[model samples]
Target: MTRVAVVGLGMMGLTHLNVYRSLSNVTIAAICDADADRLSGETTATGNVEGTADASVKSLPAEVRRCSDLNEVIGAADVDVVDICLPTHLHVRFGKQVLLAGQHLIVEKPLARNSTDADELAQAARSAKGLAFVGQCMRFWPGWAWLKDAVNDGRYGKVLAATFRRVVDHPKGAFYENGDLCGGALLDLHIHDTDFVHYLFGMPKSVNSFGYSKNTNEPDHVVTRYLYDHVPLVVAEGGWAMSDGFPFSMSYNLNFENATVDFDINREQSLRICEVGKPIEYPEVDAKMGYDLQLAYFIDCIEKQRKPETVTLENAADTIRIVEAEAESIKTGSAVSLG
Candidate 1:
């Protein structure tokens, strides 16, 4: 069995633990967190997508280890994989630690806060003995995953125009209030769509973005148009600036030469296709959530001793670079040329 340790007891951390427990050949060897209460299961954290923690996750099994120090977890012989679910700022520091220890590493999305740190982390992953994978989970998400396949296989002919959107109420926590630490919604939230956009259609030639800030000086709501030569129109909008009661939304609309695909997380039929003189078709996807799918992929990669091609350090770094360009565009109120 592949032993795994998850650091951080936040929403994502707990989510990772749940996923790991459900897998066949994997075991949660340890859980690390600086917060004593979190480490001991006195308090719980939640995310926008999933609500309160499951009963099984409120506390781990007796055999599973718990520690407050990261070093101890990395040094443990029983641990073969360290999943870093800490804040964005801590990713680079702890990520390098796991790699240096020659243990498989899984760093949650955005890789790092900026290009400089991302580059540093990417280099460490390259030189490390163990394999590295970034948690760009959108690539594995059900509806979103189906969209990627359709784009590549051209089931409905070339994509004519595509628009993606994700929006939710601002998240709570002091860490979020500080723009530098979280990179605001543009980096923390919108990067999901940005990375997915890259996964579907390579990097764009240029990007024009518009943004609005509600809590901090940094942009919280962002709408970017990705310019490309082959595709006629491609745009994405994401933010966490909605009101308290606003429901979480992640949806997309794609117009292909002969068909159109529409996806909404809130809809009963999440993914639907339309074509002239034909009935709408709903495509079925894997029942697993993106988090579970991503972790499973990494476990398979580790077991096979194969490198992950789906989402790599370089690819994650490039996603940051693209988001940085979007931030610049938001500042200048003009299109930023990436080429």
Candidate 2:
């Protein structure tokens, strides 16, 4: 069995805890949150399988052992892996600790605040005997998996052009209100879509972007145009409409050489896939929590001694380079070339 410890019990942390409950081979050993009440409440409410359950909301049995300190959970004697749902900047720090403790590490996206930090963490992982994987969950999303398979099978014919949209209401405060972690939509939300674009087709040759920072200049939204070696890509945002004011969906369109693809990601189901021939239900094993698939894959990579499809240091840096270009374009209000 893979004994796991989850740190952070906020939005993403709680979600990770929920997913851990459903895994049979893996057991959630502990959960950490600064708030003792939060941890205890979640522990009792979720039945130790789910986090603090709110009758105000729905309920499920939680499996994680909740705590307040991150290290105490990850450093536990039986911990085989540490799944970090902490703030962005802390990814590298927590990752280093996990690796040093001889436990495999799984971090949520952006890897680190920037390419430089990501590189350093990558080096640490490389030197450590345990495996390290980033939580680029979109890669394992069943809809995307279907799309990639089809493209590789030649259904796309050559992959023409593709566009992505990810937006939500802007956040208030120091941006990294949680910690000195990575903040803003670019690193937080954009990384998923960017990872997709890069996976479907390698890195783009040039990137031009127009960006926006809420009250300050941190980039809450961006519209990026990328020039791929063989195709063109556009990743734009509707601005974060993450408030009660907006009724939204995270959807995208893919224009292939032979067919056009549209994905209507559902509220709680597999993404709807449509093409010229016929529409198909990709039958997503998970809708909201694809992290389970990701976690299992990473574990397979570690226990089986194989590298999973999550981003590598070079790949991560390359993605950030394009992201940086988008940031630049947003700043300059001009198109930036990729090369």
Candidate 3:
């Protein structure tokens, strides 16, 4: 069994802890959070294991350990992997400590603050034998995974273009509002779109993006144009600020030579395929607790000694490059070419 630790006590951090619980091979051996009370209380929270195993609406088993020091949980103990659910800026610092301690890392999106740090982490992992992988969970999303294969396998038939959109209400938390944290929707939010898009489309030749930021200190929405040879790419990104309705939403439209696949993780929870092979469908994901699959994938990667779909340092760097370019374009109002 692999020992696991949840490094933060926020929403996503709690989700990571729940995931560790559901997996038989992985154990929630330790949990560390700055908020000692929330960390300790989470052990008995009812909804901790509810959806994809996050919301419980029940009760937690006793005997769960809560630690206050990050170093004890990450460095001192025999934890096999440290799940860094901390904010984007903190990812690098914590990940470095984990790697230096000869432990593996599985962090949330936007692996580091900048491309240089992303590269350095990648190299550090190279020197550490126990180091396994780091990445976001979006690629493991079943609906998106199936469609990526369909397009790559020619089921989509000479795919011509693609579009992605994700929006959410403003994050009502101090961690999200921290200025020293990652920038705009570009870094924190759009990185998801950029990483997943890169996973599907490979590297883009150039990038052009324009957007405005909110006083809360991040772009609530953004439009990014990716240039790839002989392909059409336009990704519109949004998140958490357009909190007008009861539920936030995300949708994607994929144009292939013969058909189109429409997937809405928020609205419908199913993929609607048109013009070919009858309408394809996907299972609706529970938003509140759908993180189990992602955690499952991470455990699988650790077991298989393989890199995760969207969590590799390479993929992280690519996503960062797109975001960096987007910010540059926002400043210069000119398209930026990428290598």
The per-model lDDT (C-alpha) reads 0.90, 0.66, 0.70
TM-score per candidate, in order? 0.97, 0.84, 0.88
lDDT tens digits, residue span 1-339, model 2: 788777766555666666666667777676677867556653322211122222211132365455677757766887888888777778888889888988888777778888787888888988886788887767786667777787779865776767777655544434343323444677777777777777777777767777666533366666777776677545545345255334334567777766776675544553454556776545554343356677777767876887665656557666776677777777787777766
Better of 1 and 3 by TM-score: 1
**lDDT winner among the candidates?**
1
Candidate 3 structure quality by residue, lDDT tens digits, 108-142: 77788888888877778778756546556677666
Model 3: CA > 4 A from native: 42-60, 244-246, 276-290, 306-310
Where is model 2 poorest over a 10-residue stretch in terms of lDDT? Answer: 48-57
Candidate 1: tens digits of C-alpha lDDT, residues 191-242: 9999999999999999999998886668899999999998999999999889
Q: Which TM-score value belongs to model 1?
A: 0.97
Ranking by TM-score: 1, 3, 2
After best superposition, candidate 3 residue 336: deviation in angstroms?
A: 1.0
lDDT of 2 at 37: 59
Most accurate candidate by TM-score: 1
